[model samples]
Target chain A: GQQVMQIPQYQHVQEGEDFTTYCNSSTTLSNIQWYKQRPGGHPVFLIQLVKSGEVKKQKRLTFQFGEAKKNSSLHITATQTTDVGTYFCAGPLKSGYALNFGKGTSLLVTP
Target chain B: EAEVAQSPRYKITEKSQAVAFWCDPISGHATLYWYRQILGQGPELLVQFQDESVVDDSQLPKDRFSAERLKGVDSTLKIQPAELGDSAMYLCASSFGEDSVYGYTFGSGTRLTVV
Candidate 1:
């Protein structure tokens, strides 16, 4: 079975600080997607990386996919309170269409 | 923006009791998935449906868990004899495609607690 693992289970940062979370997959992935889940809320789609050595940016956030297609990272610049949540990275299952999600990195930004 | 609809934002049941959750995905979306999230963890896929047919259920506990999307529009998940360990957030998500090529749209989810 494929497994997606995330580093830094929890992070607490002051407002205006930067934050980053890393994700690694046990097997090569066709693609990887990132999601953000607010406290007590459902996961929301953030971005998807399909190409090897890809990098995409959205506002203050940046996402990178490794050349091997087995690792990814999300970095947020100048974090704000609204950025507080758990970030998860998911990859497609080897045997099916379902996704295998990493444990997630919980972010807490304080004012 | 269309949304996935889920019923009963929360639920609490006595151990050994039965509980059910419902979900309605966005219109015309052909892929639906049910996932369970334990506290402080990522969502784990319970089942997946393509149209009205099930594509995966390997992680679902068949002994006490069941799910169906009979008409390929809305779906239901049932847990019989729920146990304390069954406490978790049950999420339903839908995507326009069968794979992660298109990201998922998730419902608010049903938080369940078994006492």
Candidate 2:
């Protein structure tokens, strides 16, 4: 069974602070996807990374896939109140049907 | 921007009662999935359907839970004789394709509480 683990189960920061969440997998993954869930809301797709050592950015958010494709990271620069939510990373195992999701990093940005 | 739709955003029932939730994915989407999210936890896949056929249901509690996507469109998830531990948010999502890269569009989810 494949499993994904995320570090820093919870993080709280003041506005204008930076936050980062790390995700690691027990098995190599073909691709990794990131999602964000607002408080009391369903998860929303953010981005996906396929290539090893790949890096992608959306505004102040930066995503990185490890060179081995077994880990990933999501970093937010100058967090805002709107960035408050749980961030999750998911990747497919060999089967490729259902994705294995990390426990998620809950971020809290205080103004 | 089409999004997945789910009904009965919240439900409260006594133990041993039967409960059902409905989900309608974005039109033209080929894959649908049902996930459960306990409080303070991430969503866990319960079942996945490729159109009208189930592709995976290993995590589903088949003894008490069942799901169907008949007609390759809307779907339903039912839990019979629900227990107190069944309290959680049931989420439905759909993807344009089965690939992980395509990601999924998720519905608001149904929060169930079995008292």
Docking class of 2: medium
Q: What TM-score goes with each of the models?
A: 0.97, 0.97
Return the DockQ of model 2: 0.70
Q: Which ten residues in a row have the lowest lDDT in candidate 1 chain B?
A: B95-104
lDDT against the true structure, each candidate = 0.94, 0.92
Clashing pairs in 2: none
lDDT tens digits, residue span A1-111, model 2:
338999889999999999999999988888999999999998999999999999999999999999999999999999999999999998876564877778899999999
At residue B12, give the lDDT of candidate 2. Answer: 99
lDDT accuracy of residue A84 in candidate 2: 96
Fnat of candidate 1 is: 0.71
For candidate 1, lDDT tens digit of each residue in A1-111? 338999999999999999999999988988899999999898999999989999999999999999999999999999999999999999985755788999999999999
Candidate 2 C-alpha error for residue B91, in Å: 0.1
Tell me the docking grade of candidate 1: medium
Model 2, span B36-55: residue lDDT tens: 99988888899999999999
> Over the stretch B9-112, how does candidate 1's per-residue lDDT look in tens digits?
99999999999999999998999999999999999999999999999899899999999999999999999989999999999999987555669999999999
